[model samples]
Target chain A: MTSTETHHAAGAASSTDAPAIATWLTTADHKQVGRLFIGTGLVGLLGGLVLAVLVAFERIDAEGFQLLDSGSATQVLSAARLLLTFGAVAPLVMGLAVAIVPLQLGSRSIAFPRVAASGFWMWLTGLVLSVAAIIGNGGPSGGESEMVDLYLAASVVMVLGLALAALSIAVTGLTSRAPGMGLLRAPFFSWSSFVGSIALLMSLPVFIGTSVYLYVDHRYARAAFGGNFGVNNWVGWAISQPFTYVLAIPVLGFVLDAIPVLGRTRLAQRPAANVAVGLVSVAILASLTHRAVTLPWEGDGFFSGLGTKIADLLPFGLVNVIPLLGLLGVLGLTMLTLKSAKPMLAAPLPFAVLGLLMILLGAASHLLYTVEDAALGGTIFEAGSYVAVTFGTVLLAFGGLTYWGPKLWGRRIPDKAALPLALLGFVAAALGSLPYMIAGFADQPAGVVDGFAYSGPQELWNVVTTGAFALMLLVSLAFIGLAVRSFTAGEAAGDDPWDGTTLEWATSSPPPADNFSDLIVVGSEYPLADIKNSGKVG
Target chain B: MLTLPPAPQPAPKRQVFVGTALVSAAATMLVGGMLAIWSQFRADAPFRESPRRGPIKDWMPKDIVVPEVAANMMLIAFFVVCVMAQWAVWSAKRNDRQHAGMALGMTLLMGLATLNAQLFIWSQMGVDVRGGAFNSMFYAITGVMTFLVIAGLVYTAVATFRYLGRGNSDVPTLSAHALYWYFLTAAFSAVWFVVYVQK
Candidate 1:
């Protein structure tokens, strides 16, 4: 028998029994759930991009009522934050974990498949409700208290669903591995998901409790989270700084694992890399330090006097700086791993490199926010920084999709399409964020529309940011077009696409219903590599 | 014909047992995190200046009575129910079916009794939910716990019924259910210690 036939003959089993639509909707299969998450997240991402474009359009004119009213602008800003963070990134990562963790660990299915399905539905429900509520003018700054309450309730439910999904992934990672697959031997993506899941599990619940109380106060008492506190605090904990880093943690895994496979080498300092991922959990707690920071800068002179402002970062530096340190650790180790490896010519490389750069850009911006003289908080710079990190996740998610797409859809996303898209994504991310950072240094504020006194440089910056956002929207469209096309009609990908080191590569592209026909005993992190060298299917 | 090993099954027996225990521990962490945030908010809440801070009003009747005897009774009964649940699991594992059934049945009865007592406590509360931040927290935490308890009781009841009907039970499944029950017990104990007894 051919190697492909031998591999398929060994472990393939038919676990799916229902009709197509029914199967997808009711699937306990990790792959389908992952697809569901990715599809849903893509839609959510598109929605967020559309909202961002609208906001960008308004910002282009730098003066009165360019594209939206004050209330509309505020609503769009808040909605984009909600959709991108809760509706897009979390789902994207969770979906990948649900689909990939079991396969990576050499398990047939996730530990709690039904629970994972339940979590998806719950998340979908929450996302739909929240998006609707926000669109209907029903959040913190929305005039009506009832709408705000709906917003609060919807957000809580959405976050809860994400928490449930993370819980399932974590438990699966912890419990469902093959007989000999120790924690250290699990794929980087699985390990990162495990750590990120714990972080989400611990953090989201606090947000839920706070939201519950917000509900209570709004509904009856009117005693807590007054003024913009309700909205700002939520943004602070859920979308900003350390929280975003923790959310971005899985992408680090995606890059780590993808790089090793693409580079044809084992991870350098694997244990240290795992610890770097682990450090993010502690870094999540450090997110609280941001609440104490406020920016009071008035002009470009802030940069000229950087040393004095940086010194102001000392008091909050211990906690506020941890996430940056973690990112640096990841970057340092990734470089070390790549140094010894024979890197392949592949699409994931550009995506990974750009992803790390964007993460660093965001981290640098976060550091600036902590510096008292930098006075960058509540400005376009901070928002730009957040976009950078968020965009980093998008790139990583795209990289993961590109890396795993063949295995998932039985087709490679034509490199002709993917390579250009990755490059465009990087340029767009840079254009989208860097100019805004300059504008923030120019003393341009964030989260406001139709109010700032128009200045020459500020207007120029706004125009640049607007143009970049327009390009980003186009890139997003092109990506969606390529992804959909490839998913349906692209060239067929074989079992091992990237000479991947992990277990998932051992099975066929779009693995069979039961994942594998026979169990593959995992002896090391690079199990598939071992099999390849041994010239055996099993 | 080569038969591939059966498609990866759900977590193995021991893993299921340990996994559920881990979930319970995580659940505790969640509850603990919530409490920590709530306490911080409680401390910072602008209580004195609020119009809602005054005596109980006529329009909004009090739903929760503070420090009621029924509240204490409910806590004690919950403890008893938790103990009975463990007894049922232990008896079943020891192959003592009769005692297991009896203990499980008693556990369910007491669980319902505890729920009813909590409802009683809710009715007797001298403060409205809107009375203050403390009042809001007290109700929110307890109210959520009550709903959780009902859900856990239903789950345990189903597991118990299956055991009685089949004349056999999967120890892991039973243990998982029991583990969740214990989580509920521990969570409620925390609420009792902080919200009811200490406050």
Candidate 2:
């Protein structure tokens, strides 16, 4: 066995001591389950990326495809593209969020990892069934009854998984903690992750429940969105804005986490982060309430009518902008702080910096929910922006994982040179997205398959995006290799590697199965730093 | 050899009572559903309109827009029964099994009644979006009510399964699942009789 395993063995009897498959199934050992959660989420992310690339190709050349010279219309292709927007991509992103946030909080694992695992399995099953139905020529209009039913089932599974993950995270946050990790003292990223987890747990179900009804009626009951004659579009609108929050919140966490470390100061204000989270949650609920009465809800609708007027009692959406402004101000503060702060080229810093920059672009633009061109949104710009934001968060998560992974494994990855690929991955994606922004400005239809047949800046943007994508892929592959190697074969990390703050780094590199056996008292935010300065070791 | 007294059989007969009440409520729901369907559809005048001034007609004049009276009445009654049944379940928590069972029986009877009412309403519309937003409101509200009734049935069934296996049920799971059904029923019923009825 490895030294880390020997250290783990020295601690106490282990869950791994159980028979093989049952050990995985029944173990409450948080680290094992956490690996499963992260691995599963990454795989899901990869699948989502594949779908994204295909959709972007289809949209870029909307005029048709001449590669086959088979007479394909943009209208037909766009319908398929629309399906990807709601049906495929959104759910994929959500699945990833469910897995990532819970781990960030220093919880052993989510409350019900089995349920969490089941949720993933059920979700995949639903996706396969729904995608198959669609691939076999199905939309709300074209699909048979069986196909629609299957799609509804798939949505249920995705929601179930999200709910399961959310609950697990919340429970862990509330009941499990690394001793001395008070709610107020939680790592900003973990705090944001905690708040976002709660928001998602509640909000996702309502959307999932409504979406199922929409699918049911569209296929089996009424043409809700299609038949414009007298349909109540409230559900349609509810689906849109709440979804934006689901997409935004975790990245919000990423941005929050990056600021303090990168800036070399405490957050501009702790309460500001708390308020941002609360405002966002309230905003989501109030906005949906706007839809609770009407057919289609809008960002503005939640504030306008009698029911909306009552909801306007809070003007939460407006209040929401306040925290964001405060956050932006803090981000600005961080920029100022980073100047004075020591710039270290460690695993977490460069990616943390790039990721934070990307988040600034993403979170800022999303705050303005005004309708944009579907053609524009469908363009490579939107995809590029999504990649920028996603990679930024993913990069931060990688840094956090690596920074703490050794702590969790009791082995800091030695050979720091193995880190460039991870940083490169973030840089490549950030730069890659640049071309898409330009292509979108030129009105190049994105997600299109063929290019030469069309002529313009959109085409030029598409070419650039494709070239950038190759770089991104290379970087990503390198990142995976580096990560896998470090996780398994890197240098032995001690319990306190970074002279860190927080309780997780205070105890054994990986704490016991029950987490820290005794609650450590917190005298400062960075507890381990003081310990390290004192040169305290057993 | 067996000299049990009929007057006072035993002390602490609570579990038996609660179990009986649940089983009976399930039975009531199933039976009432059958009776409502038989009475409304088995008779020849399933679609006949009532010209006479009924208490409900006076209470909600707008409800008069729908021509059929029997289905509407059954629907409203079922909505009431669902509320009563949930009340009974709530009371059972206090060891009031008989009251709980009675409440559940009421809910089941009402749930069945609502189901028949739905069938009648569906027959009237043939699923068409007519009678203005009122028609849509009427159908949507009742449709939600129907789903709740079915959900209630599932929650109780899951509870029964847990009870059989563990001796004590997963109360949180039951509460989480049951609370939604109860609220949905209460809300749908209230909307039907309170909001849409007068509108």
Candidate 3:
């Protein structure tokens, strides 16, 4: 038995003590379930990357390589989006939340363990059915009507699974904290997860409603969305300027949680950080404005009337700039925290810094996009800026896995391989997105298969984007390889490897079935730090 | 040997109540979104004539026919079910098992009636679901609510059976179930006003 098992042998009566395939499949242990979520999400990432590469290859040539017909291209785009947004990034954050929140809260297990496990399975089923429908040339955009039904059904099921998981996580946060770990004192990630879960709970059902309408429209009543709604509109907000930032809110939480720990100091303005996270949740309302960015309805129609009404009722500038406010709030808090202490050059720092920088770039671009100006509305720049921001979450998720690897798996992902790959990831992301933003400004239209015959700069930009996409694929594969190797063969990481400030570091690496050997009632944000320095915990 | 602290068990009752509340909160957002679409389709303009009031032939392809009176009847039935559900909760809280059981049974009956009313409305509609956005939305909103009503009915049935059979039930679960019934009542009323009365 391992040292952790030997130490906790008295309390090791559960099935988690037996590390077998059956244990993994059937275990309701939050840690095991979390690992399953992360692993499944990785599979999704690989699939999304392959699809992205195909799309990029098509974009490489102006005549748009006839590798897939336009309908098939639409299918690929939809599938890639579902895989990345739901399959990869959302699950990754959820996995981290599931694994880390309870431990940070000093709770032994997640609330509603069976519900969470069921959610994971449901999510997998939904993802498989949706992807299968796409592969079979039966998606919402596909020619076959039945495929469209499959797409709608599968997507709704997938969202329901996520909603279930979010409910479990949110409930655990509300009622399962350790004796004295109040809301303010709860670790940043756990608190952030709670907020993000609430946001997901609130937003996903609206999408489900939309999907239900689509299903009804496609199946029985052919009247709604005016034949315009499909997979494209389902993710339109997700790929667009403002609402896409809603997806990045949790990454900001990761940064908030990591900054104080990486700096080996207390956060500068903890309440303000919490408020900023709250502001990000509030920013979800502004997402409705994304429709205005693309639609040219200044004079007539319901959209114009509603837009004018909304502008009059609310602070137009403030509502439009909610994401900017949230991101800047994070940046300001980060700078304040770094100012108070000497930050060590560590594994998470590069990922944290680069991720935030890319996110900022995306937010800045959004600020410009939300402007009344229509010049850059339909350009390749729209896609470019989106790629930068959405991928920022990808970078942050990688860093989170690294930052919490020891606590999660009893080993650290070797910095020798990880750090360099982290840098390469940032480089590829910048190269991939910056050119598109520039090309977009040059009047290069988006959603085009072939290069426009009239535009010179669009071709040059597409070539650069294609090359950058290839490089991104290479870096991603290498990073995944390094992570797998670390899981199997990396050196052991003892408890508190980086001298973390949170409660999670107080336990053994790959903490035993029981999270802590002893209960430590936390009175401050940095509970472990206090215990190590003063020899007493609150 | 390092003796770890035993893990604390979560309060399952509290978890159930919280989970129900959260789901109800999410349901509110869905209603809001559906209303947003309804408003957009109505267009609210001087040039756009009332499609419902126009010649029946003009409503052939895209416009859907809504059964206004039947929808209003469903709303009233749902509201009555909600009242019975609240009575069940109140009786349960007071440890009045006999009253709670009767109230819950009534809730189940009313919920079934509401579902029946919905189906009757669908059967009575002049156009099928393929009629267009208005028809599609009419089905979508009512269809989703019908499912919720079925769910509430199952919960009420279980709560009623548990209370009647064992002289007790999980009060928290029952209460939470009632809360969802209340939500369904409010939601149906709002949808009724927008889709039927206002139009």
Model 1: per-residue Cα lDDT over B1-199, one tens digit each: 5555654433266655655666666667556755765656545544333256673222222444364577778888888887888888898899888998898888889989889988877777755767766666666777667767887788778878867755444556667778888888888888777666645
Fold similarity of candidate 2's chain A to the true chain A, as a TM-score: 0.74
**TM-score of decoy 2:** 0.67
lDDT per prediction? 0.76, 0.49, 0.75
> How accurate locally is residue A296 in candidate 1, as Cα lDDT from 0 to 100?
40
Top candidate, metric DockQ: 3
Report the lDDT tens digits of candidate 2 across residue range A379-425.
44554555565555556555555566675665655436546766566
Q: Can you tell me the DockQ of model 2?
A: 0.07
**Who is ahead in TM-score, 2 or 3?**
3
- Chain A TM-score, candidate 1? 0.92
lDDT by residue (B1-199, candidate 3, tens digit) is 5565664432367777888888788887777677676666676322434456653222223444567777777888888888898898888889898788788888988888888877777777655666566677777877787776787787788777766654434777778888989888887888778766655
Write down the lDDT that model 2 would get: 0.49
Q: Write the per-residue lDDT of candidate 3 for residues A1-538, one digit (tens) a residue.
A: 1124423443235563566987776767788788888888888877876776677667667574578776577678667767777888778888888888888888777888878888888888888888887877766477777877887788888888878888888998898887788999988788888988888888777777777877778777665553423556643564455665666666677788888788877788888888887777765666553263332335455665886756543554555566577778888898888898688777677788788888788878766655545467766677777778767777888888888877888888887778887798898789888987887777766765555544566667777777776777787788778888887788888777787888888777888876776667777777777777786532
Q: Which parts of model 1 are misplaced by more than 4 Å?
A: A1-19, A227-229, A288-318, A454-456, B1-11, B45-65, B165-169
TM-score of each: 0.89, 0.67, 0.89
